[model samples]
Target: ERPNNSRFSSCSVGNISAVLDAVRDGRKRDCLKEDAGAFCGNKIVEVGEECDCG
Candidate 1:
């Protein structure tokens, strides 16, 4: 159950994929991340990395 002051969401890969595809096409709205990617983020990045808006 969510607390009165906080909210939680469930993972929906379909939604995530749609957003990712839209970003690739420059058609989706995005949010900015306050911090850079985590230390492990780069290790997982591909040979040609792309930008992340959130």
Candidate 2:
């Protein structure tokens, strides 16, 4: 379950599920690319990423 905070308050279960499904199905691959110096904070938790607060 998501925390009851303003950051995730607007995020619905359906929306999060859809995103997770897309990631699992490789549909979000194109959007997961990161530059040489960019790793986290893009909002999409890619492989090896621990967390993304931004």
Top-lDDT structure, candidate number: 2
List ranges where model 2 is wrong by over 4 Å: 1-3, 6-11, 30-54
Which lDDT tens digits does candidate 2 get at residues 1-54?
357554543458678778889988988866455677546776767778778776
lDDT of 1: 0.57
Error of 1 at 11 (Å): 7.1
Best by TM-score: 2
Clashes of 2: 0
- Model 2 worst lDDT window (10 residues): 1-10
Clashing pairs in 2: none
